[model samples]
Target: MLGAGSWGTALAIQFARAGRATVLWGRNRAQVEALARERRNCRYLPNAGFPAGLTVTAALTDALDGVEDVLVVVPSHAFRQTLAAVAATGVALKGLAWATKGFELETGLLPHQVVEDVLSGDVPTGVLAGPTFAAEVAAGLPSAMTIASARADYARRLAESITTDTFRAYTSTDLIGVEVGAATKNVLAIGAGISDGLGFGANTRIALLTRGLAEMTRLGLALGARRDTFMGLAGMGDLVLTCTDDQSRNRRFGLALARGQRAEHALRDIGQVVEGYYGARSVHQVASRLNVGMPIVEQINRVLYEHVSPHDAVAALMRRPVMAELV
Candidate 1:
């Protein structure tokens, strides 16, 4: 693991519980020392206990030493630098998996794309994504996820290695589809949260979710991903969980936005980079470049960065020219 955040810690704990020698590499040496000594991540996931087989280290080389499979769980913005750091260590990675679920703001490349770009020249890489809360997963609650790679065999191997009775992993060869679904849903979840925060009823929320799925499908199809993948666990399952659950940081950010908080203020109060905030801008940029129609995502980007009020965004969406639902 290359991060010590909540999601990274949860995955390390999970792999450790499965009897794997899991080493978590954190950026902060003091935090790593505290987690190693106390057997807990006091900052992000305080309720969860670190498994016996799990170890924490601040030294990236120590964590990368003799590690066959590397899981990069860093924030999307820091992914390129982290990968470069790993490359500088001159460690040969056998198989790689990324759990990050956002696009690179600089390049608009998806997480898996960033992995492939950073670890170029025939490196086997995969992505894990779905409807999972880090806290619940760390606490050993049941959850499901999709592991996708261009190679079916590699995907299956990763799935089998990570899957347990409580944690189910499904394998897919549609890496693009899986990644697109995962990244795009975060943007929509913010819209859903805004609705909830504004006291919109279930009728409006359900409508937004359904439309949001359609927009995601359009974007995915434009990106050459299979439409059905957007209807699967990595897509619909993630969308439902992030949009409806209060635990979602993206949704919480949207709630703050709806409650008249600025995006920066909400993020500061939440104390985490809501990937959806950056994801909205990235998706909007991609949609513009690809000439794809995504009104909801556009509204989100406008509200987030263009200074468009959330009320005006909603009203503008409602006032758009009506079209057939099947379109």
Candidate 2:
């Protein structure tokens, strides 16, 4: 683990549970030291105690010392920087994968692209993603995830290394599809959260989710991602989970926005990185660049970046000219 955040802490617990002697690394020296002393990440993953086999480390190299597989679980914004540091270490890692689920903010590149650009050799790499919430995984509840890699062997290696009885792993070769779906769903979750916060009924929520899936599929297809991948765990599955679940920071952030809170204030109150808020602008930019028709994403961009009222955003969505549902 390369991040000490909720997701990273949760995954470290899973790795330990799976009988691996896991080492979790974080950038914050104080936080890593605290996790070492307390055996729990109280700040991010409160009430979740670390397993005996799990060791917390402030030193990046210490965490990678003789490790079989390395998981980069940092935030999307920090993914490149952290990996750049990992590359600089020259540890010659065996199998590497990331659990982060968004694009690089500056270059709008996927996690794999960052890995390829920063890292030096042909280090077997993949991504672990799906509709998983860190809290549930930490609690050892049943959860399913998708591992995508260009190299099927790498995906299998990562899946076998991390998968536990409670945490299941499925593999796919459609890296672009998986990543595009993962990054785009957070933006869709914001749309769902806004709808729910406005007190919309089931019909409206379903509409948002369904249409949001279409928008996601459209963009994914434009990016050369497999169309069928959108229906899999990383696409529709993750989208539903993030959009409907209250534990989702993106959804909660959208709810706060709908409840008349400023973006900065709501984000501060949430106390976690709302991936949707950051992803929305990037997705919108990508869609625009591709000339893809992503109305739902457009509305979310207007509401989040352009400071359009949530009500007006919905009204605009509703007012769009009707067309065939399959378009």
lDDT (C-alpha, whole model) for all candidates: 0.89, 0.89
lDDT of 1 by residue, 50-102 (tens): 88888889999999999878998988889899999999988888888889887
lDDT of 2: 0.89
TM-scores for all candidates: the values are 0.98, 0.97
- Give the least accurate 10-residue stretch of model 2, judged by summed lDDT: 101-110
User: What lDDT, from 0 to 1, does candidate 1 have?
Assistant: 0.89
Best by TM-score: 1
Task: Return the clash pairs for model 2, or none.
Answer: none
Clashes of each: 0, 0
Model 2 Cα lDDT, one tens digit per residue, 256-277 = 9889899999999999888888
| Worst-scoring 10-residue span by lDDT in model 1 | 114-123
